[model samples]
Target chain A: MTVLAVAEHRRGDLRPVSYEVVTAGREAADATGGDLHLAVIGGDVESFAEDLNREGVDAIHTVAVGEEFDHGVYAQALTQLWADVEPSLLLAPNTVNGLDYAPAVAERLDIPLVTDAVGVDAGEELVVTRELYGSKVETTLAVDADRAAVTVRPSEWAAAEGHGDATIEPFDADIDESALGARVTGFQEVGGGDVDIGEADVLVSVGRGIEEEDNLDIIQALADALDATVSASRPIVDNGWLPKDRQVGQSGKVVTPDVYIAIGISGAVQHVAGMKGADTIVAINNDPNAPIFDIADYGIVDDLFDVVPALTAEFQ
Target chain B: MKVLVTVKEVAAVDDEFEIDGLAIDDRYLSYDLNEWDEYAIEAAVQISEAREDVEVVTVTVGGPDTEETIRQALAKGADRAVRVWDDAIASAGLLDPATKATVLSAVVEEEDPDLILTGVQAADDGFGATGVTLASAIGWEWAAVVNSLDLDTEAGVASVHRELEGGVEETTEVDLPAVLTIQTGINDPRYASLRGIRQAQSKELAVQSLSDLGLDAGALDSPMEQTSLYEPETEGEATVYEGSAEETAGELAALLREKGVGEA
Candidate 1:
């Protein structure tokens, strides 16, 4: 058995999830008693190969196709690589770009593909553990196939580090330019506004628990009382209650505030990805079983409508 | 021109719920149209409203119980609805993305729609792969996590802005006759009006089974099996404060002061 893990990059730099993918692939490879092979497509493959040469990696394959990701090019190149490598398991990141191409590769190869796996084990069978119903519950799926593909959830595994002596090889993927149906035009930076939540020392982040847009006044009042910056989860920004600059999540700004007070936030995984690095975390929600409490250092299980005003008074 | 939107009826568990065997108890679950699919439906409806001779049809893989949810899409301005269900589908256990793409591709074959839209991921299972998988199965173009779409049917191109991680958007152009997985915030989803609800009651809703779509029960066959379901153990060692709102707030305030918060 062999495990092939693909590295992800955007613009000019490799995303941090690429190292995490190597870690996940090494674990699967260890379980199956096989060697781990890494592949980096497009955008500075020579440098990416050198950087991806982690300790557990047995070999590195570089496919120099284009400067950036084109799903059509990826689908064709990965299929050709799959035919050559014939690995038992294929691992890819569960990023936006990964979702863009992994499905097509798996579908073209006629293999079972599981996305957003938090846990992967390859013993007698492949078992993948993932969250359902928005992280309210976890379920384990057993794949009854000899070969399968899995897209690993980011930040679940620690990054692979240290140097290795893996052999580097270049594979010629003759990508058909005419077969490409989609073309990348350009990239733009969104979320530029009056505030940069990333620099705040203290943040008062709100979520769907705020109920209505008009109710954001209480959150604002609380933030004002504590002299903290106002941030929000995806819903508030999606509702246009706050500008995109104030949103904190995977697609938003990653903030590492000193004191993070989560008011009415249930702490979904995507939202957690941004603020989990805060020094001290507090959660105020009515539901005790909310996942927010699982990471909070101090939690008050009460309605935000009652607690916000009361907590605001304490600071004032 | 025609647009096909994939809608799913997702089950959301209550704050406190019980897990019965490998699934949550029905008593503690409530069904609603997936959040992401709502955006997809709105995108399709907007396209229909903007052009001439355009029809927006919704396809769902659920039983009769989902008709009410499907009607919500019709009420939101979809022209019609298609529900694909069968006993084989019900007993298939886990309807993986591949199985779903297989089933939905058959409908694409029959409908021959020029554009297909689906949510980036279903709120329930969150597979986030069916739209792309279906596109590959049918050999059509696709884009994922699209937050903005500018479709020109005359030019056969759909310009989109894909929401990448860390506040970056990638602009891309996908050829028409493509499947784009819509992300939230693409557009404001409108609430169904009372008049629209009444019209939706009389709208056409056609149900098809595997055989009806020229597929057998084998189409539901999948290699994935859900073995267990359980709530993850809480890992936090937080010192939860117990008391009234005033009491808890007082405790938190003292701690915040100790941590040097709220000092001018």
Candidate 2:
């Protein structure tokens, strides 16, 4: 059993998840007693391969194709590489770009595909653990196949450390430019507004629990009372109750405030990814089982409607 | 021009629910249109509204119970709906992305739409791979996690903004006859009006079986099998305050003040 993990890069720098995927791949390789191979495609492959040659990596394959990620190129390159390496298990980060091409590669290769895996056991059969229904429940899936592809969620495994001596090779993939249909044009930065939630000292974040746009007045009042900037989960911003700059999540701003009070937020994984670095985290929600409590340092399992007014009065 | 939107009926679990076997109890689960698909439908309808002779058809892979949800797409703006379901599909333990792409590819063959749109991932399964997999299965171009789309039918290209991590977006140009997985907040999905609801009742909502789409039970066969399902053990070590709202608020406020939160 051989494990091949693919590294991801955007712009000139490799994403952090690339290192985490190495750790995941190493673990899977250890379980199967197989060599762990890492591949970095596109953008400065030489430097990326050297950086990805972390502990437990046996070999590094670099494919210099494009500067940035293009799914068509990725699908073609990975599919061709799959035929060359013939690894039993292929691992990639469950990032946006990974999802863009990993599935197509899996389809072309005709293998079982699993995404967003938090846990992987590659003993007799590959078993993957993932969340469902907004992380309310977790489920484990078994891949009953000889070959499989799995995308590991970011931050689940620590980034691999220490250096290793690995054999590096450049694989020349036949990428037909005429066959590619999608082309990367440019990149843009969004969520630009007056408020920079990332620099706030205190944040009063809200979520769908606020119920209606009119009810956002209470949240604003609470933010005012605490003299803190108002931030929100995706739903509030999606509903137009708050601007995109004030949104906190994976796709939004990652904020590490001094004191972060989560009101009515259930702390979905994406939301927690942004605010989990806060110095002090507090959650106020009606549901005790809400994932917000899992990461909160202090929690009040009560109605946000009743608690917000009282908390506001306390600061006032 | 025809735009095909992939719609799904997702089951949202209640705040407190019981796991009956490999799924949440039916009584605790409420079915509704997938959040991301709402934006997909809205994007397709917006295109249809702006262009002439644009037929927006929604395709769903669900049972009869999902027609009500499919009708919601019709009520919003879709011209018609196609639902593919059969006993073999129901019996299939888990329809992984590959299996789903195989099933949907058949529908794509029959419909031959100029453009196909789907949610980035279903709310229930959250695989987030079906659209791109379907694109590869059918040998079409694809863009995933697309938050903005600028369609130029004459140019045969769709300029899209794929939302990346940390507020960065990558703009790309995809050739026509592509599959785009729509992300939320791309558009404001409209509420179905009374007149629209009345109209949707009479609109064509055709149900197709595996045979109807030139597929067989083999299309539903998947290499992935769900072994177990359960609620994850809560890893919370938070010091939960037990009291009235005022008391808890006082405790939290004191902690915040001690942390120098409101001093500024």
Candidate 3:
């Protein structure tokens, strides 16, 4: 038995979670006394698979195929792969692509499905843990099924590198074209320049308290000083103050970083779902009663204009 | 063109949530219209106010609880309301929301709307797959995350201004009978009018169920699978380093360097 870690990619660039997933898969494989298998499925995934290879007892499986994630195709191929490999545990990132086909795979195999997991441990029965209810609580679940598939949240595990010249192998399956009923005729890739949120080390997020579009300069100045990315609550994006790429919420990009400094924002549940995975959550909001303060590891109550400038000057 | 927009009744975007073993405590949740769906409705109303033939209607999928969301839409001036309740689909063992979207798309196809709109993403799943999935289910031309729209019934085209990264906006002109996933910032969703608030109760709401869509809840394919729930590892402590500007700047740079930036 082995633990399979599924990697995510957009237009072929590997998602940072590939490292984190391997870190997670290694843990599961270690406890169950099995190997770790890293699977990359998409077009042009060879270079990505090699980068994610680990020496933790097993091989890397690359499902390089003509199919670019047709749900039925992925589901059927994964189901067959899991059956052939008979892994003790399977792990995937809790991502759009992962969520797309993971359930179908679980449903086909009759395995317990656990998602948005923060931690996992080995035991007589595998214990998968996830944050529940908007970062307010931690639920550690002892999955009731013998065979289990899980999607691990990104950034939770710092992928620990071990020594190995790990071997790479390509996975070829006889994909039934009929199963791939829906084909992606074209894809709109979110263009790049600064790092994607998943890979950012630090993020300075502004909430509704940012007040006006003019106030963003001080926030950007602060981000510039800190070399951090600028992000915001839905209100800012919805107000056309910023692009949708900057929106961080349940309806936006879920990000995990080393440091997340929230400024002038009330923590709404929607916003919390996205950034709850951050390592150090520092909230800067005037309202003590603001929902943001509840999940903030550290809190600052003051005017954002004054506070943000002070922080910017300090960082500069 | 009476535009009928569909919204979903989901765990509120603001509700406090808790998970006790297998059960999620939904008490803190307030059922409201999906935020992005509200934009679609708001856009429809704006079009109706500008055009003579257009009137906005609100449609939703859920159990009886969905009726409240419909009422809110009515209170905001939707001319009519329809509720499709497939209690079986509403109550299924599968954890996929796409299953719901699949059922919804099949039902929506029968309504024959000149154009259909949804939010770019739903708050609950944040999967952002519903609108695209619905479009595929019906085989309609689809454009996602549109910040603006202009409906031209004459040439049979819907002009959409799409939001992209780097503050880029793409203007797309799709032929009529298309699906648009409304982006945020389309317009502020309007509040209910007092006259309309009172009239909401008087509005005739036609309620249907999954049976009406001719869907056997079991036949739908649930694509996404979940494995287990794990709490995120806590990000380490972030102690505020308060000091003079010079001291803090020096400290901040040292910290960044320690994290391996500017090391080379």
Candidate 4:
């Protein structure tokens, strides 16, 4: 058995989550006692492949296509590569690009696929755990198929580390031009005037507990005093209180800031999935049983309306 | 041009969800259109309103009560509604995302719509597999989790921006007859008007079964079987600080300083 991992890159550079994909593949490969092979597919991605010389990797396959991301090329390349390698298990990031093509690749090859897996175990069959019902429940399914493809969620698995002298091999996907039905034209930032919370070092986030749009002024003030960027849960964005780009959750951007201040947020599983990587989490909520408190490094079980103002004044 | 949008109705479980064996207790559960599908319906309606000779049809697969969800889509501006249900499929156990896609692709073939749209993922299953799988099963180009969409009917192409992780977006252009799985916050979904709801009452909601579409019952089989369903284990336990609002803030600020979080 062989485990093939798809490395993700953006703007000709490898994203941090790519290593997690390798980590997932390493686990699968170890379980099956198979060699682990990683593939880096993009324009000028040769250097990106060098960054993935992890201890468990057996080899790296580089496919240069002179484009950052093209759905048609990606699907075609994966399919063609699968035909060549015929790996028992395939792993990819559960990001936007991976989801766009992973399912299609599975359908094209007639293989079983599971997306957004947070837990993975291999034995007689591949067992994976995924969330359902708005992230309120967990369901574990066993994939009995011989061949399976999985998209591992970011931040769930530890990034693959340690150095290895894996053999580097250049492979040509040899994708047919006629098979390319879609082409990437350009890239656009969402809302032109949106905050990039994913890159923030310190974040002061709000949620439905902020009450109304007018209440945002206080939260903004606290963020300003702390010199931190302001982000929010889905309700703030849905109600137009905050920009969608500022929303942090499973459906939104994943952030791993140095410090995350969650104010009045109940810490729904959907929201927690994105920010679980924060170095330090501080939660302020009146409800003692709110799930957010469970994950918070420090918690204040009091009304945020009173606590937020005091915090702002203290910071000032 | 005809557009087919897939919609699903899901139970709204509040705090303290009761799980009876493998399924949640539906006694206290209320039903609503899957939160994500509302964005898909809104996108379809916006396109239909902008383009001439375009009709938006919403479809779902479930029991008879699921028609309420389809009617909601019709009231929101869909020209027609459809429900696909068979007693046999219902009794065969849960329909996996693949099976759901197969059933939906059959409907797409019957309708022969120029475009098919659905939410990025259903709120219940959150598999995020149906739309893309349907596109593959039907041999159509597709883009998932698209935040922005624009179609040039004359040129037979659709341009969309897919929302990626880390706040980055990639734009792509797909040939006509494509499937787009819409993301939330693309646009504010409109509320159904009173008159539109009245009109929807008289509108026809066609129901189709597997036999009607000439699909085999085996198509409903799921490749994977769910062995267990349970609540995830909670991670770190919290150390709650009890004090007045000002005292709590003071303690929190000191802790942050020790942890090297906020500016000191």
Model number with the top lDDT: 1
Docking class of 3: incorrect
- Structural RMSD, model 1: 0.8
| lDDT for residue A118 in candidate 2, whole number 0-100 | 91
Error of 4 at B209 (Å): 1.5
Worst 10 residues of 3 chain B by lDDT: B223-232
For model 1, the stretches where C-alpha displacement exceeds 4 angstroms are none
Q: Write the per-residue lDDT of candidate 3 for residues A1-316, one digit (tens) a residue.
A: 4787777775557767778888888888777677887777776778776677655637777787753545555666677788777886778877655655665566456565667777787667777665543454455656555677888876678774665556677767668765343334444434444556667888888877888889888888888877888888878978878776787775568889887888877775557878998876777766545667667776566666766776666544
> What is candidate 3's CA lDDT for residue B156?
78
Report model 2's TM-score to 2 decimal places: 0.99
- Tens-place lDDT per residue, model 1, A28-118, is 9999799899888998999999999989999888999889999998999889988898899999999999999999999999999999999
The candidate 4 chain A region of ten consecutive residues with least summed lDDT is: A186-195
**lDDT by residue for model 3 (B53-99), tens:** 77676677667877888888888877787787666756664434346
Model 4 / residue A154 / CA error / Å: 0.9
Ordered by TM-score, highest first, the candidates read 1, 2, 4, 3
DockQ of each: 0.89, 0.86, 0.15, 0.60
| C-alpha RMSD by candidate, in order | 0.8, 0.9, 7.8, 3.2
Q: Model 2, which residues run further than 4 Å from truth? A: none
Instruction: Tell me how far the alpha carbon of residue A88 in candidate 1 is from the true structure, in angstroms, after superposition.
Output: 0.5
Q: Model 3, clash count?
A: 25
Candidate 4 regions exceeding 4 Å error are A191-202, A215-229, A249-259, A266-279, A285-291, A300-316, B241-264
User: lDDT for model 1, on a 0 to 1 scale?
Assistant: 0.94
